[model samples]
Target chain A: MADAVSTPQEIETELRKVLSYLTGNADLIHADANKPFKELGIDSMMAIEIMAALEKELKIQLQERDLAKFTSIKETVETLLTYVR
Target chain B: MQALKLNKHEILKHVPHRPPFLFIDRVVDLRPGKSIQALFYLDPAADYFQGHFPNHHVMPGSLMLEALAQATCVLFDITYPSKRKRRFYAGSVKARFLKVVQPGCELELNSKVISMVSKGGVYDVWASINGMDVLRGEMGCMCVYE
Candidate 1:
């Protein structure tokens, strides 16, 4: 479970791992984290998948409205932090 | 939260699928917007078995996935009765075939809504024969309003 002590960098690393695995882009961790997922070739379906994966990994629950926050790596980490914190 | 059960005939009303293409035979349990449990009988004489294999017939894995998807559609229709007219399309699926399903096997299909999205939702689906796991996976479904 992701606790309050979890840092932004840790969350970012996990998010990058998920993005790289889902998008098959190995350079995701080193690329611009602020790039929009659409620009990174992530579609609506993939967005849904990322949310599902994160919820399972972090042992947290995210609502439908949070789907939009998955636009970029940084945004996703922030959204996840709100729950963990 | 009472368990809703639907027979073969009643199942048709909730989904647009018909014979041949229809994979679900009956819905054993359903919780609108939450989860669903259905069944399908793999008839040995089914057309697909003829070409799928002549000597040894095995239920196509894709059809099993389709059955799970159809079950999700039924759950969706019941959850939102007003959207019954809409079409349910499965956008993405990640599945693992654990066992070989042969003809005459009674497929027990189960799916649970993982989360609701803008267009549809994500679901965790699995199937078993005689309590033995055959397939397990997650899929995304979109309710396309026509």
Candidate 2:
């Protein structure tokens, strides 16, 4: 099981990987994961776009239950990792 | 070199439909593993759209749901000959509408079979623009072969 996002370092690493795939800006992978999506300035629409990309790439369908009723990279990633296993 | 392309002409053999009545244009790609990409060119004059939303002219959610079923039916058609083609009906759908689909939106509907029992299956179908999802849901149906 993926260890819970217990450390800022672990959270950042996963966030950076997800952001790179979602933004289509492969270069964005270098951003600090601790830098909140808000700090990086990701809007809800962009987050949804990224979620869609993640849905396709991961081959894991994110359902209504999977959305977590919140919008943000970290929250979404946590939700995804929770359901993925 | 394309492995799967179900054109309008071939669609007739697989579906009991005709011009004006047929809502789907083509099944562009299919991975026998139960994944499909389909196309539908909307016409404002389509009978269903006429009354679905008097002024807004949106594609009915029910029809969008039908497209998902039809896509799944075609998958069965491709895998099973007419002799064994079964009857399938909607069991349940956890659907969500994210955007308004206009009269001219060339929608691409894609789905993948997620789970199956001996007589039924579940499909994850999403409505999209090019590859951008517009509406999404999972449809459960009973695959009953007569």
Candidate 3:
């Protein structure tokens, strides 16, 4: 289970790790968190990969509607916060 | 869930593909909204064999993916009956080809939904020959209402 007190910053950090691994772009840690995934070189397929990876790492289930909501890291972190216990 | 089988005639009603382009011949097992197992016969005289390799003919890898995609479409149709009118559009796919598929082989296609929403979903799909794994991958698809 994720830490109940996990802050958005913490979630963002974890998300950066996942994105870096999936895209093989280590600089994502420093990249603008608000940048859209498309501008960051992530496509729809990669988005699905990210979602699947997050589900496994966080031990959470994301709904289908959440797939289209993966616009940016900041936005994704906020969405994840709602699901994380 | 209990497995439901569909013959070629029944499969035609659910799948829109036709001869030459149609990869699946019959569905052996189906669990709506979850998973499906189908089969395809790789005929030796298929037109692609004439140039695919000349004397050493082999089924193209892309077609294998198409077969998997078609199976996924069938699963989606059965899973969401209300969305039967919608067309399935394959979005993105990540696949690994483990073995070469040859002519006259019976391809066992299988697909399982990993995640689904009202409009689309992601699926895990694979195909095998004589129980030997040939290809496996993850595919994303959308149901186009148009």
Candidate 4:
């Protein structure tokens, strides 16, 4: 297993920055770190926008079935950490 | 309340876009990894129209590119955020036009995922109206982050 993360807080910190960036780059939607995209209202197109921005901004390769797990903010952040380290 | 109707307002819930830039007005359906049908109305008063063809208006190819990008972005927003967020964007896009997207013409964009990679994905998209292929292209995108 990967190094155990101390808490979900570490994951949220990374997510907050990513989500904030998503809100800026994507012209289709608005969201904060605390706000889950599903709650803030995100569909496939919007999801695709944020995903593109995140890929550009984060510099990570998350393609194919990798997308299946990162369907939500919490899951995305967790997944991001997986490839990052 | 017709069963097969979606307005811009409803679309907003799924996409992260505001006015002037957002292209796809509504999505008729999203069948997971298969295809997507989106609606857009050709407006003579659109911001880009003034410059694209002062005398004869035509939707520029760049806007179509952005539309594809925007629509795909919105798709990821609803389908996979936290994971794909770190992995979504167009690496390549090629389009061909058989006819013009004139004012008042209702446009429909139909796209299907062709292949997915470790870094990005490719989609085969066809833009049509009245069951005619007006524009067609293959879009390739990726997610690069750390």
lDDT of 3: 0.84
Query: Estimated TM-score per prediction?
Result: 0.88, 0.58, 0.84, 0.56
Q: After superposition, how far is residue B122 of candidate 1 from its true place, in Å?
A: 2.7
- Cα TM-score of candidate 2: 0.58
User: How should the candidates be ordered by lDDT, best one leading?
Assistant: 1, 3, 2, 4
Candidate 2 stretches greater than 4 Å from native: A1-85, B17-21
lDDT of 1 by residue, B30-139 (tens): 99879999999999999999988998898999999999999998888888776435777888888999999999879999999897654678899999998888999999
Query: For all the candidates, what are their Cα RMSDs to the real structure?
Result: 2.2, 12.6, 3.0, 12.9
**Tens-digit per-residue lDDT, B1-146, candidate 2:** 34588887887777655676666789889766477888998878788787888877988777777877777766656655556656666656778987778787788888787753334456787888767787899775655566
Please report, as a value between 0 and 1, the fraction of native contacts recovered by candidate 2. 0.00
Whichever of 1 and 3 has more lDDT, that candidate is 1
| Candidate of highest DockQ | 1
True contacts preserved, each candidate? 0.57, 0.00, 0.26, 0.09
| Cα deviation of B45, candidate 1, in Å | 1.9
> Which has the higher DockQ value, candidate number 3 or candidate number 4?
3
List the TM values for chain B, per candidate.
0.95, 0.85, 0.94, 0.80
* All DockQ scores: 0.57, 0.02, 0.39, 0.06
**TM-score for predicted model 4 compared with the true structure:** 0.56
**TM-scores of the candidates, chain A only:** 0.90, 0.56, 0.90, 0.56
Q: Is candidate 2 or candidate 3 better by lDDT?
A: 3
Judged by DockQ cut-offs, the docking class of candidate 4 is incorrect
